[model samples]
Target: MIGHVGFTVVVIILKKEDTMRITGISSKPPLLFTPLFPTYFFPTHSDRKDENTWINIHYVEQIKPLKDKKCKVIFVDDQTITVNISAHSMHHQYLNGIYYYYMMDRAARVATFDPDSPIDYTKPQLNIYEALAKYSLFEHK
Candidate 1:
């Protein structure tokens, strides 16, 4: 899939394995969390004064479908991260994904992910797939 973010286009080719049910727990709470969408750091309301200034703004500038590789992203609401991802879009996806996991894990200080269940993005059985669909890394190809 070709991920278009601003003036950049990121071509991501994911094997079926890459898109499989690979799960990971956040070692600690995320350094940043969106005030609006409390489950994720996207679509964050900028007016919220408590949001952390994420190390680099590029980690979530674009939303794309990453299949079933969804992970448990923890949010502690009290701390920030040490390392940051690059702002450039030309970076490789494998490296970027690794860094993404690392940053989230390192920043978290609240809880570990539960491996027994798939993360249900829909709110309380609301089944709002459309609403939760906006949090991807690429659009479905």
Candidate 2:
């Protein structure tokens, strides 16, 4: 819009307004589900075996993306087990991201990640924080 004030000219530009957004990027879709906390608990009806570990995880305890990026993290909360994944945005088509390894202690809702080993998808992941927010260690934090 443009208006005239005496001999001066004034212009106004307008932009659309949307509130359901994380930072400047709209959360339309494509929120990747990756684990944040990696805790190890003995699987039921299973025996302890090798020290070799698989990588498939099942839940996201804390979600931390780049301050200005839209990427979302899905991880479980463990005592000493943790996974460190590095990515650019909160949204992507998968594989266009980067990830490394970390140690964690608690187990949340996650399947498991095996970069070099086979996994049983028929099993269910368990995320207790999400199930019991009030009881979660991160309740107020």
Candidate 3:
């Protein structure tokens, strides 16, 4: 049977090498827990699996702090869950989740390009000025 460390290793492997690279760049190495899906789930507490509470970044509507140093996370569907973490800490995790999501998205976009695809030479290429004019904010008469 695979132990905890073995399971974690498998997860890291499945997540790809980019996860480690991103963790290094962000200066926040995922310790005991890493996001199952970077864009979807993030742990409010990452130190221990027993204490960790995963939240869906997309569904989070608001985070409110309680008097006892905990946070209440409200979801888009009006569901709320109180986690034993400070509001500031929870917010930090939320922001980190967003950052990871964007990083993974950018990596995916870059990795999907087909270098061998033939470029259509018949289509005229637009210069910087023409491209800017075409997408300019100001309306043209």
Candidate 4:
């Protein structure tokens, strides 16, 4: 399967280990949640604001299927990790069996994904899958 990734990341500082922080606003010293989604730092319309409010969506960079692998004996003496790999796609389980066409082709105007069960969907990886599955146009047989 081939697809493109859209990034909505919040560009922050460049620290050691090549790190990145999103557009969350900082509060306490040794900051708690900075530039994250649903931050009151921006205009947040919640259920408290109205009966039908737009849900705060957490944006992600991409759903990269990791096809890269490297193996090395960093530590010895029974410190071995036999990497059992599998070929798989991403997006939350809730988006199970959603075809790719319905997503990008039709511009995603009318579609709904049944959330993956046993899923908290508190994160992007989970949320995307459930959302994607609503449109089965790109599902695999």
Candidate 5:
């Protein structure tokens, strides 16, 4: 189990999944349920195995810093919650979630790319190939 906070429980049944290899996130990685619509949920605390709140990165509207290194997070639906973490840290986590989503989406695209399929010259894909090579993403092959 990932953890349980309040009434919410997160459990991953997959065994020895390489989340870092697939998502490029080393710590406190956001959870992505579906690749069709990539929405990431990030933990409020550092440890994922601890009792911490998980917030959807897409729904966060604003983060207000409070005293004692805590912050209040406001959602797009006007719901708010006070978390025991600094606003800076919360914002950094939010950015990390976005980065994780981008990497996942890119990986999906790369995996689905067919060498035999006709390329769309109108939309150039050379840069993506170059970036993958530079990062050694295809080195294992």
Candidate 6:
């Protein structure tokens, strides 16, 4: 009789597993899920990934178009930093626009590359510091 009671208790414990399963209402839609984060089902931050690396718009001096849908970006601070990027890249799509990247830590939100107005490097009046202050992902917090 004691062995039969232990077997019944095991069956009761196994039935509790159904409570953890998701019903029809709570599951996320297929279209809404993107592979932006490395792990969607299980989030682990053991690997420190560069989430949102940004560039200052005012520093963009020249954008030389290259073959194979690439462009050579000329950004200047004390010196020039040249980066070859894809033309279809979010950065390339919003060229000369006010955008900043993460300096120290990963950004919490997606960096807004799309701006209202196109960036004009010829305009000396454009304030680099102000743009950084306004659009930097860190500033949003």
Q: Which candidate gets the maximum lDDT versus the true structure?
A: 5
Per-residue error (Å), model 1, residue 46:
21
What's model 4's overall lDDT? 0.24
Candidate 5 lDDT, tens digit per residue, 1-141? 334653243333220033455566666766655433434778787554465787888899999999999999999999999998899989988887887766655554565474334323245444455334324442334
Residue 9 error, candidate 2, Å: 65
TM-score of each: 0.20, 0.16, 0.59, 0.14, 0.63, 0.26
Candidate order by decreasing lDDT: 5, 3, 6, 1, 2, 4
Deviation in angstroms for 54 in model 6?
Answer: 2.7
The candidates, ranked best first by TM-score, are 5, 3, 6, 1, 2, 4
- Report the Cα lDDT for residue 89, model 3: 83
Give the C-alpha miss distance for residue 65 in model 3, angstroms. Answer: 1.6
lDDT of 2 by residue, 1-141 (tens): 434642231110000011112113222211212233322121111112333222232343433454343333444555333223233322221211121111112211222322333222234854343334212322223
Instruction: For residues 29-80, write the lDDT of model 1, one tens digit per residue.
Output: 1222321132222212121335423222334333223324322222344333
Off by over 4 Å in 1: 1-89, 97-113, 125-141
Deviation in angstroms for 76 in model 3? 0.9
Model 3, residue 121: C-alpha shift (Å): 30
Put down candidate 4 lDDT per residue, 1-141, tens digits, no spaces: 323321211211121001112112222101112212222111112213432111111222223333453221112233432221211212321122122212232322234232233334366544554345333422333
Superposed by TM-score, candidate 6 places the C-alpha of residue 44 at a distance from the truth, in angstroms, of 25
CA shift of 12, model 1, Å: 27
What is the RMSD, in Å, between candidate 3 and the native fold over all Cα?
A: 13.4
Best by TM-score: 5
State the weakest 10-residue window (summed lDDT) of model 5.
7-16
- Across 1-141, the per-residue lDDT of candidate 6 in tens digits comes to 559878864643332221122111111101101112111121011112333223444455666666775556565644543334554453433331221122211222212343434434357565454345333422212
- After TM-score superposition, the amount by which residue 6's alpha carbon in candidate 4 deviates from its true location, in angstroms, is 38
Per-residue alpha-carbon lDDT of model 3 for 11-93, expressed as tens digits? 65444334445544232323213322224456766434577766767889999999788989999999999998889988888
**What's the lDDT for all of these models?**
0.28, 0.25, 0.57, 0.24, 0.64, 0.33
RMSD of 4: 20.0
**Given candidate 5, what's the lDDT at residue 50?**
67
